[model samples]
Target: MMASQRGDVSAVRALFVSQRASPYDVTPSNCGPLRFAIESGSLELVQFLCHNGADVNTTFGTFETSPLEWAYKTRQIEIARFFLRQGARLDYLCFRGWTPVVLLFQESSPTVPLEFFGLLSGHSFSDFDVQDRFGVTALHRAARWGSVGDVHALLQLGASPTLTDNEQRWTAAFWAASANNVATLKRLTEGAPSNFIDHVDFRGWSILHVAIEAGGLETMCLVLELGVDPHQTIMVESEDSCVMEELTATEFARTKGQATYRCFTQALQLTGYNISVIEDSDTELVFWDT
Candidate 1:
């Protein structure tokens, strides 16, 4: 395990040749030798382990993570592709019920290629929408952080935008909105019904409301242009007193600050709604001649 982690191909080979260690041996943390090789970020070391009977499909660790998942987690795109070519399972669920595809999007760097998704042709439409423990699907992950190309690829591969997470019952569209990904949100709802955009969460917070509070000015404008009700209200519970209050999207934006409030009102106005703008007296001081 130490040799593999250090990328010492010669020492690892010596261990194998001498029959002193098995390629399948796992550390106390349940990480197999293959995982250690992957952590070293050396394709040569990884290939050596696999050639010596390392189980590419074997899931170790508490999360039940596979070698393919490790490859993705480490940003080894070539290794991931190699694992795919070696027939690694794409739909296997790991920690927190995250599938290999879902975990790929969870990565924060090295944007995944659209061609990479093409390798996962064995899965059915339902397989792409497989949810995690929180009912968060690959589409939800893609919508949140993956590129527009990533979202499109998932959609083409049968991921549904309508699937909702367990906690907020937030659809992929909602995730897109909260992430301020206007392009992704637009693409996700391109041909969808008006009710889809206007659909509210468990707290009665619509996509418009989410855009107003968590999204940017452009996102808020886009939601309004998409026919989301500007006057829609949500019942929010206060964290301190647990007080439930119903507030419209505009009113909710006010709590976010003047800039957000102004953005929402301007969006409403552009969409031909009659929203009266309230002046902030605190922002202006009277100048009197003394």
Candidate 2:
């Protein structure tokens, strides 16, 4: 383990030959020697360990993270590809119920090459829309953090942007909007169903509502321009079950306080709403003229 962590191939080989250590030896924390080799970024050492009997698919840690997941987490694309070629399973769920594909997107740098996903083609798995335990898919992760090229590659590979997660039932477009990733949002919604942008979560919060709550002024304006109704209403249930309050997007923003209220008002104005602003000693008022 020490030699592998240091990436000393000669010392590791010597230990193996002298029967001093085995490739399957793991740390007290359940991390294997191959994990150290991969973290050391020594592909040669990794190849040697695997060739000498280290299991390429060996999982370590409480999450049951596979060797391929380690490579992806460490941004070792070549090592990851090697593991995949060695029959690394993409379907293995980690502690978070995240598959290898979701991990790839979640852990990879934003600059990861588009070709990175192309390697999955050699693998037998085709369900790119598979979700994690949280019901978040690879596409959702990509939309939040990946480059446009990454999203394009996933789409080509069969990841569905329309799929929603378990918590919020938010599709990739909603995730992109919440992250203020307008470009990714546009790319995801392109050629989508007519009602795609109009989708509301379980709470009846639209993409515009999500943008406002996330403090993304630009995203709010973009969604409005994209045709989300600014005056769309959602029913908010009060503590009294018999009393329900109807709130519009602008009204929802008001409850978030002054800064958010100002932002939403500006977004409405920018999108061509004839809003009149009035200031009083105690409160600010806005009137939308139809």
Clashing pairs in 2: none
Clashes of each: 0, 0
Return the TM-score for each candidate structure: 0.86, 0.91
Worst ten in a row by lDDT for model 1? 281-290
**In candidate 2, which residue ranges exceed 4 Å CA deviation?**
235-245
Model 2 per-residue lDDT tens digits across residues 108-139: 36656655566666666676887878899989
lDDT of 1 by residue, 158-240 (tens): 78888889999999989988989887888898877657866788878888888887738788888888888766778877656
Candidate 1 clashing pairs? none
- RMSD per candidate (Å) reads 4.9, 2.6
In terms of TM-score, how similar is model 1 to the real structure? Answer: 0.86
Q: What is the C-alpha lDDT of each candidate?
A: 0.78, 0.83
Stretches of candidate 1 off by over 4 Å are 18-20, 84-87, 122-126, 238-242, 280-290
